[model samples]
Target: MNDHTYKITAQDNILFVDASGPFDFDTMLQYKSETLEAIEKLKHEPWGCIACFHGSGVFSPEAEEELVLLTRERMRKNMAALATVIQDSRQADIQQMQLSRVYESCNTKYHIFSDVKAAKTWLANYLKKQPN
Candidate 1:
């Protein structure tokens, strides 16, 4: 319930974020921090990840800037399929742009979705289409 906390669901190769609740300035930062940590913790996870963000929060200019910088700070730390989902009521342009940056900067597959099923489907299809 704390603004600086998040819920993590780590499968064998998938890390899901149920960011469906009330978030504050700190919570957004924690999302970035914990996501980097999770990627490191599950570095060996075979399939990768599908993170879902669903809630209301105040994302500060600083947090949004850091989100844009994840490419350099956390790229080498993971190769997960980072998928972020936010409601239409929210302003996630910065986050969406950040995710796009992640795809461009890192050597991993990235996709943006407003739906969980779409994101998961992309991950599964991506893994299967890759060479062994």
Candidate 2:
């Protein structure tokens, strides 16, 4: 059974994702599917993402690999930037390490944050700067 859960919403060219994880591969696949669906519904081009991760926020290796692929696909689909929020410092570090690999490999722009407000502000500014 999949233990991970996520809520994805879009507003004004930004995708907001609230996710809690100790994710399995299936959970990652579901996340990718739902996020892509949300992306298609967005009315703007060159969107950004604010992903707030809660709880353990750890992904299995296979799940992490799937996320890497999804991140690349998101970039292809005009996801211009990503801001990730994690409250736990240790978990933040771990998540950063994992996500850094994914974002770097995809050559996607991203930042990790401890506060959701800061993440939203950064992503808003980042999206504003992107050429529509």
lDDT of 1 by residue, 58-99 (tens): 345665556556544554554445666665436567556655
Model 1, CA-based lDDT = 0.61
Query: Candidate 2 residues 1-132, lDDT tens each?
Result: 555778999987889999988788888888999988989866358999999888777888998899988998888789999999986545667877887888898999999888999999999988889887
- How close is every model to the real structure, measured as TM-score? 0.66, 0.92
RMSD of each: 3.7, 1.6
**lDDT measured at residue 67 in model 2 versus the true structure, 0 to 100:** 92
lDDT of all predictions, in order shown?
Answer: 0.61, 0.86
Model 1, backbone clash pairs (residues 3+ apart or across chains), number: 0
CA shift of 16, model 2, Å: 0.5
Off by over 4 Å in 2: none
Task: Locate the minimum summed-lDDT window of 10 residues in model 1.
Answer: 71-80
